[model samples]
Target: MPDYKKNSISLTGAVGLGTGVMISAGIFALLGQVAELSGSWFPLIFIIGSIVTAFSAYSYVKMSQEYPSAGGIGMFLVKAYGKGTITASAALMMAVSMIINQSLVARTFGTYTLQLFDGAQTEWLVPLLGVGLIVVSFLINISGNTFIQTFTSIASLIKIIGLSTMAIAGIIVADFAFTIPNKASNPPDIGIVSSVAAIALTILAFKGFTTITNSGEEITKPKKNVGRAITISILVSLSVYLLLAWAVSSNLTLSEIIAAKDYALAEAARPAFGDFGVWFTVILAIIATITGIIASVFAVSRMLAMLTEMKLIPHKHFHMPGSIQKHTLVYTVVLAIVLTVSFDLTRIASIGAILYLVMDIMIHWGVFRHLRKKVNANPFIVVSAIVLDLIVLSAFLWVKFQSDIVVVVVAILMITFIFIGEYAFLRKTSD
Candidate 1:
């Protein structure tokens, strides 16, 4: 049996756990892409992304109140449908998305780290850094949550402090680059669509509630704290994101920014703080991303643990403790291999972001569907949730359809693998 602890974390800790796990992508890197997409509408994009995500967070709280457990959205999807292949597929995706998300961060961290020094290419530096991050976090996992939780708390603090410091620094030292009123624009084209998609990409920076779910075994007050932490985490993360967007946008012209393209935060910081700014951000990125990697390693390990227990995966793989802990280390090493081999942080984060969005939407969609039919909750509320989620799904699919054919194919292949894996598991169990 799993040794469960009650309220090991305060309600505040639950919220911090979510924000801590997810906010690395949102803050340390993403300004350049967001600025490019929003054009003159960066502020609007930030607010819109926050509003939509706020609703999604609310859905999570509502669902958590109903079915709180460490299983995350996997459990939510499973219980709603009475458990089947669809549930199996959902859990598999969640498990993979968590892996993909961390890889994206690990890659980003490596890239940013190498960039700190002159004539250094973040391209190669990032991969090695990614492997190192996996190794470090894996060690943290073995000590158990007693150590892991405290370390994660520190990582969470680094993220907030770094971002806040950057925002404040930008305000004090960096120039405010606001859009001129009444800038003429044309009808939206593929260029525009891609740009909006990029801004939507900014939303990915704030997605990390699963870390809290993965830590479910450690959480003391599961029901109350899970929902509480998720909500607070998203809100705090959003606030930081909004501040970042504003800081970066304030430092460059809509046109100079769109032209300069990538890493606007670094470029913006360079002018105001000069050498101080660049070095500070580089160090900050390293610290913030290290924190993110730890959070990611923890989340994926637990998700794997849950899937193994549910019989959807081979029983031997779930590392509960002792022998099981090795599974977490193995998963960490596998992610390191993926991260070390990959150089393109944007593409990596892009694929990860899209896959995660699909899972999040599906998780919420399953909840809404269940509440509407089985629970017979308020039709009006349920309809609103469904309608809003439909908008999110449409946006997600539309963007995915336009950008990468690989993501779509990969998603299908992943689902295929899940069924095959599950089928093989059942066969072994019967024997």
Candidate 2:
């Protein structure tokens, strides 16, 4: 271990990092898909998703209390499952999912920004901008923790206030009639099953709370503050998501939302306050995505560094300069850039969501079945977390399987390859 400084971030810094990741571009990009499944009640779906997320958060909260480390979930998994392929694979899945998230956010930055331009439908514009952002984030990340914290705190504040203002503005201008402009091909009656299933997708909006746990070692008081940070991040994110969903649902018709699905919030703004509103929402998105990528890269790189120190996964440097953490930062950014360039936005989001929920399921189950007594965690909460994750994950997988089987297969193959590669590496190192 490199003995990095502990307690580097204050309480506000921790919360900022949490919100930086949670209130991400994912919210902007994913609203339409969730609404398609959820119909007119999409805002309520966000509320329901928060309840489901609360259950999943229980395991992480308890684990952080018992074992606070920079390693975060990686450390928790090691405690529950030991230093083996399982821990290594789970951690890598998480790291990769976050990398995918950076790409998702980066691409979102591109999509939203281009909306400000005329004839902005160029083919290569999005990935180019996405890669540019990743490079910028890498530079900012290497500058040190204070800069990262300060910038993220300020950005988080701006994004939250901007989103709130948009919501309120939309509400003030709305006529209170909630109606979908173009009726869907499916029946108008959206049942509870469909709404509950939509929780699988909506969960993505709040999943970034785990980014806070990755900074456990840096928080001023890990045991007390990590939990608080996670709780605050989710609550604030949920509030923002609901407000935006309400604003969009109330202001824009269903067809308008789906029509500008790539940039729904911005499109919704057009009807509410015209071009100025459009620019306002796009600017907020650009800021949100930039901060989101930086926060994610910061946390995931530290996590990979921790995993390397634990020797649960393979690590090598081609005579790189700076610390192991810096090398990990490079690796994280490069991989994210590749995903940004290669995959489309929807595919990247699906891959990330699947990897994340699967990893969450493993974490919850590992704790529930093995470490419940060890950590003094409530078995029921752990169990509920596992069950909720299972239901949501199953719903998500089924939906993807029906809509895009290739993504699900790709995700499964990625997981399998990570496990096999880890096992082989461990065997060789042991020998």
Candidate 3:
């Protein structure tokens, strides 16, 4: 049995972990992509995304209140669906989605860091830096929870302050006015479907709250604090995202933001504070992405270890020495590195968004269908989460199919493979 350290994580540290993950590449890397999809009014999507996520969080908060465990979503799934294929597959999907998120943040780290160096060959260096950062995060995580918590807590504080200052300064420089394209000037035609689909990416920005649940077994006052940390993290992220989005829009036009999508934050800085601003933004990005990976890897490995401990997934020592958590840490980093090397940012975010939303829908439905009465959750909120997730997910899929069918296909294949593999494993074990 894995020895989870109870009371090792405090409420503040839990909030650190949550916001640490939320404020990373989610805002720095994805702002422009959301803008591209939603046009000049992209900032509004962050608000809508938060509202949607709040509904989804109701089920998770209720579940955590009832069943706090290191397994997090994995534990929740087993409670709702039992230790069956549905549980295992959905749990695995959540794990994989988190790993996908790590790679996304890692690559974002590379992209933003490279802004400090002009004329550098980025084709290979971006992945190289990303891999290097993931390795460092692995080292930090292995040092134990205390060090990870301290690092994330401090890093989260720095990022929140740095980004907030930058956003506020930029807005002030722009005289608190946004350069929204005039309707008569014929801006990019952003449809309602496109704007709703953009919510998928924005929700990805806030989904880091779920990481708080993964540490429930270690948090002080797991039942009350887990939910509190999640709520606080979401509200904090919403504030930062809104201010930053407005700041970016205030500084740069929609075309410029879309053109510099991958490193939009850095570009947004240039217009407000010149080269110094760009450097500041890059430094903040580096901190945010590094800490983000540390926090994410910390949660993801534990969740996977929990799955292994529950015998929901098969594990191999591979001649590696250490506990199951250590092994899962290695597995998590390797997978993230592979993804960072294989996919570009756009496709990566696409895949993560699709997987996450699908898994989220499963969670809500599970709660509503089986655990609502037991958990004392509102049926309306649970079903509303399901409906909202489905709407955004469908719109996101439609948008992806129209633009990038390959991403849609890859997401579908991944979901199919997970369910099929879990089914085979469970059958073999039962027999």
What are the RMSDs of all candidates, in order?
3.5, 1.7, 1.2
Error of 2 at 60 (Å): 1.0
For model 2, the local distance difference test gives: 0.86
Q: What TM-score does candidate 3 reach?
A: 0.98
Point out where model 3 deviates above 4 Å: 181-189
Off by over 4 Å in 1: 1-3, 120-122, 173-177, 180-192, 254-262, 315-321, 372-386, 396-403, 419-431
lDDT by residue for model 3 (124-169), tens: 8888899999999999999998998999999999999999999999
Q: What C-alpha lDDT do the candidate models reach, one value each?
A: 0.63, 0.86, 0.93
lDDT of 1 by residue, 17-64 (tens): 676666775655565556555566665666676666666666566656
**Candidate 2 residue-wise lDDT, 14-104, digit = tens:** 8888889878776888887677666767778888888988998888888988898887889999998999988999999999998998998
Error of 2 at 393 (Å): 1.2
Instruction: List TM-scores for all candidates, in order.
Output: 0.86, 0.96, 0.98
Q: Pick by TM-score: which candidate is best?
A: 3
Q: Which ten residues in a row have the lowest lDDT in candidate 2?
A: 178-187
Q: Which of 1 and 3 is ahead in lDDT? A: 3
Q: Which candidate, 1 or 2, has the higher TM-score?
A: 2
